[model samples]
Target: MDFQRTLLIGGLAIVGYLMILQWDKDYNQVPTTTQQQEQHQTVPSTEDAPQLTQAKQGASDDVPMLDSVADAPTDDTAADKQVVTVTTDTFAVEIDTKGGNIVKASLLKYPVKLPDDNEPNPAPFTLLERSSARTFIAQSGLIGPDGTDSKGKATYQAAQTNYQLNGGETLNVDLSLVDKKGVKVIKRYTFTKGSYEVKVSYVVDNTSSTTWQANLYAQLKRDNTQDPSNSSSSMGMSTYLGAAVRGKEERYVKLPFDEFEEEKFNADVTGGYAAVLQHYFVSAWIPNQEQLNNFYTRKAGSNNIVGFKNQNNPLKLAAGEKGEISATLYLGPKDQKRLAELADGLELTIDYGVLWFVAQPLFWLLTFIHSLIPNWGWSIILLTVMVKAAFYPLSAASYRSMANMRRLSPKLQEMRERYGDDRQKMSQAMMEMYKKEKINPLGGCLPILVQMPVFIALYWVLLESVELRQAPWLGWITDLSVKDPYFILPLIMGASMFVQQLLNPTPPDPMQAKVMKLMPIIFTVFFLFFPAGLVLYWVVNNLLSIAQQWMITRQIEGQAAAKSTK
Candidate 1:
């Protein structure tokens, strides 16, 4: 085999990889119709309803205003200013000071929520809103008072314009609601300054003439309206946390539920619910386990109720009695180390799939390699080399098949001359000779076919693995998750394929040869749109394989020459 043929085959492999990549891009493009439907369905039905940024901007003339003032606080210096946000058109928070302590943060995940069970489609602007996924808001003008000697911790309860915490290392913020007579309703949230766990304790003093009963409730407001019926509609809730199939074999990765799923479940409960959407999987904590079976909903312009009701254990906060329901919310990647420290079953959100039995070890080894190299692209290169080395036995056999094909070329050509115009006789003679020589002509094809699945599995592993996203590889290539800006890697990949083709001996069939010749061109075009990281892996693998084959071919030629003399 010559280097050109080796390069050609390698180029084909890159092309093959790119073909899959481009098809995914063309057909599986983002900004789907489902998102648009969800956005459209979110239009306000009444004026009294909380005004969205759109309605306030006069973009929505049909929107009606409520007779009573909306729940949104008008006071710019509201105590929970961190939790309040106005639309770009209707409201804007003017931070008096920068780098201030964030007291009450309510990072709204969606732009708007619909009144009905219909979901809203996503707007391009809405998608852009999520570009800055991390939203943080805090109190301003408190820096001078922060480092004071008196308990420097900022308290959540105080409504003072400026606050200074005690000397304690941790601070607890509260969400207190007082009645007209200045009686506490909902207890304040005592969250540590920089932690997800909040120790919520409340003291409800009933100074009223009669005692009133209330239940402690927690709501995580989200928008789930979109035109789910439209296939083009792209709903945020669905895409944010939805199951996706991977690999050519269609491997499944199930997302966790956070909604009621029973048949008899009320529309109010089942219309829409919540579920945790992780970098990999989703686990939704619903009010009850029964909610899990009602409906697996994922359509835009349709309500997708998330967050189930606590079925197994529902805490009750009685009148004049205080009860606390505390849960540590996790808002980070599906990293195994970080997730392990959270709560029960939280780590399961990172779906490795059934192949995880083998894939996990492989992933760990690659991770170790990555930690040392400090570049995911290099990590993938290292991992591919290791995998190839492990499979060398089979690969060597495959290579030997090519070597044998090269050696038998002259003999096969002579035989064709001898048996000219006698098709049946020539076929019989070739089969007999193949059996006597014990040459496995099919050996090459078998090994290549066997490795194909492994290659595909690895491709999915790299694509879906969030750890590889935004991973760097020295210079020029910043994000492995996205395509390369310059087509250098892919072009090099094409050139390698062209070289591999030149190395491999030509087949007897002219038509087959022509088709093979065109493959590199087809693949080169395909690779133009493939993810840069994927193309990088193929380029490295091909370069290494080309070198390995060159050495092996020379050794085989030397052995054949020695045998021929004897």
Candidate 2:
């Protein structure tokens, strides 16, 4: 009966955990707003410009003529399009001069795969590409009268086809274009030695007699195609692939591809950022903090666009005057520390489920431990030890309660046999026995309830931490983020769980006893698909728990025996 009650509590905790995961998935499916409906109706074809009357009217009173220019022709000639390559320590980017768009970006340090026979030397991980089947690129342009942008019908000329950092502190790639009206626009891309962020700025030099007026727009364009490399062991474990926007009222707003197709997101925010997020990497455009910007997310045919544009407060540059508009672009692995430094709430991209408050500190601790011990696997082991030590007193009490119950198991069985079919009498007799023994029937369940959040939070920390990707532990444990190659750790965990179960008191009910006996097998099957790091943590934790419970039970039984003899 006691075991049945404990199982009920465990079942409730598992149900709650599953509910949180489901809620998070559903939360990303945001409701369609009225503005989104209007924008959806106004979204024009690929060959035309999006109608801006509704958006312009909704703009702040300060800006009157805020509108987006017509999109560039989809069938632009690629034969003559010049490609500029910028090589930095962290990444290599290829930009097309047609609109100064970053069409191809490869993480120079990260390989596409750990090792493969087909490709002896695997290529670098490609973050952005422009192929016939897939189109993912970072695009920016100017919108308004006399503005020359890549997204528009303006072509730029690059100064050089290749630019290398070559151990230098900074490297710059310049793409220049002169409008028919003689407005010279130089698009400069600045890359640092060891940073993924590229500083993109446009130097608009008005060479004509009239003033140059336009708004700078930057966006990420990608299709709904999923990356084959992001597969998980199960369907429920798929990573989120979509857009996220940070604004004044909204901290972290997710705009999924399906949701974007149903409704667009349009808002004006100061110090905002728009990003396209995937499993381990993210590409975001963070505009100047002091400027008010218009952030939007919409779908164009098979592609999804997420971007922000500086408010249409025209950069009125007179003849011979030059104006520079700049923003930072981040394209690399989602390192929480670096991402947080880049923009507010950017670290949220490394999702830790719904219990972020608990997961964040746990991740910080894990990182700190990793700093001290280079091996992430060892860090997880030490983290489990620390967590167990923190809850030692509660666990000891729970163990002692179970020990008391185990000591009285014979009496409990006799009472059950005597009361046969009378459940009321059996329960009453069990309550009296518990009261006389000064044992709390629910004490053993409390420790488990308390540990559930910590364990679940650590699960996310292991799942989301890129530092564990391809990280090796001992022999055969090549990637801590992946399942054990031999399934040894899971088997060991199951053995330890079985040992711990044997130490607990047997349930009076035969049905409950059978269910309890199968728990270790059930958990072992589940852990077979979990990451090695998480499985390692559970194995270590279970071993330590068995040892602690054994010692506590022995002490309690010794005292009870002495009292009975006296």
Candidate 3:
């Protein structure tokens, strides 16, 4: 139970685990299909009508529904209609008049990158967009019996094409559609200052004699286009880019597009929501918490649609009734604080893998440190110091065990050489020597074994935290979430690892010694691709361990010198 040997084996095992993940990432890429997302265009025949992002089919049942441009005018093609633009302090969104749907959204606060200080970063990060090459947008409307969006996306008219929240608390961009019977449904998107949540509500003014009863549907649609937000797609094992929903079975469930072909995700959810998750951002539609919601996933054309509809409790209104039904739409960064406020489990979108329980506390601690330190890089170093301090007792015990083992290494080697191939005699001699020295071989390995999970969980915390994206530590290290551009930190980490290993007793087995010598090089290569924050943690830990081990080894050597003098 030599600690150095165990540590080598454990380190190599970790490298093997990472290799497996890299292999999966290399092979498990969702293949791009020859199928392009059918464009939202108008057609005459129901059979010839183009499939849209919605889950509904035109000829499905007694009520024929056509999804297009959620807009098809009986006379004029609405494709040429203008897109209403709404701007606030936080974001800019474009609403296509044909469907009165949110076709594009860009976060004003987040830029693509801050490459140089010469000029301000010009482009904001665009989350949702609809174009020839991409179709990732949020759509919401009234559907069911007398559904305004059922006939086709009824063309809506806006008072002004551009609306901006200038010195205002809230901005309301309304798209109004009127039926032949004079029923008007105003689809409104309300945005408050400094908020990512949009309250999308349908105001139904039933001017007809018949009652207007229609259910509300809100969904996120996207093509299998590359995730623009994920800068690490090429780095391997990119963060999850798919759909996540709060289901009846699990608090957080991911429904991949490929899974739809095999088995669709269908469930009746209450106080639940569905979201399209990407690298650092998310677009979710949270239906009424009290209403019975039908969550679904389907492959329409080349688009993957994940959404929820109030199917069980349709918005029923008597003739000439004035009523409304609404759902909250969140389109922004996956800010845990904002998301948690919107829904019960929406914050789970941050995704820290299987060790989320451990990762969460680590994040909370890191964030707490950041609040005090004000810089993420410095925060990470302090957090590392704090973590080391917390485990000081265990680490001290392990270091003492290693120091004793180091002191006994010569005699252990003597026993090995004296016994030669006499294995039984060599084992007996080693045990008797260990007992005489009063050193437990298992002492060092077990403490490190207990610390492994915490370190791994912290790795995930550094890898997954969006706050680390584009966050700078110091000169040349602009982003903590991505690999160090110059490979400086990893090299330092490797050097520290070698120094730490030199303080431990060498293995009696030459083959094990050789393998142990290469651990630093192997680990350095692995960390070359890891995010800078994680590498920083490892380097700091190794340096601190070396300081502690060196002192203990020195004390033991001094004691041995005193005994020889006596």
Q: Give all candidates' CA lDDT scores.
A: 0.45, 0.79, 0.79
Question: Which one wins on TM-score?
Answer: 3
TM-score of 3: 0.84
Candidate 1 structure, TM-score to reference: 0.59
lDDT of 2: 0.79
How much is the lDDT of residue 418 in candidate 2?
A: 98
TM-score of every prediction relative to native: 0.59, 0.83, 0.84
Model 1 lDDT per residue over 1-566, tens place = 69999999989977876776577567754444455446535652221122365335422211111111112122122233332221222112211111122212222222222122353533211311111121112211111111110111122334433332344445444334445433453334343433333333334555444443322122222233221211111211122343221112222323322332222112123212223443332323222222211212221111222222222233333345444433333332356565445433344455544455556667778789977988788889989999888877777777777776767777777878998868888788878877876778887679877876666656656654657655677577766655565567877888898877765656756688898898877777676656667788788878877776666677887898999899
**Cα RMSDs of all predictions?**
13.2, 9.5, 7.7
Error of 2 at 144 (Å): 1.7
Backbone clashes under 3 angstroms, per model: 99, 1, 2
Please give the ranking of all candidate structures by lDDT, highest first, separated by commas.
3, 2, 1
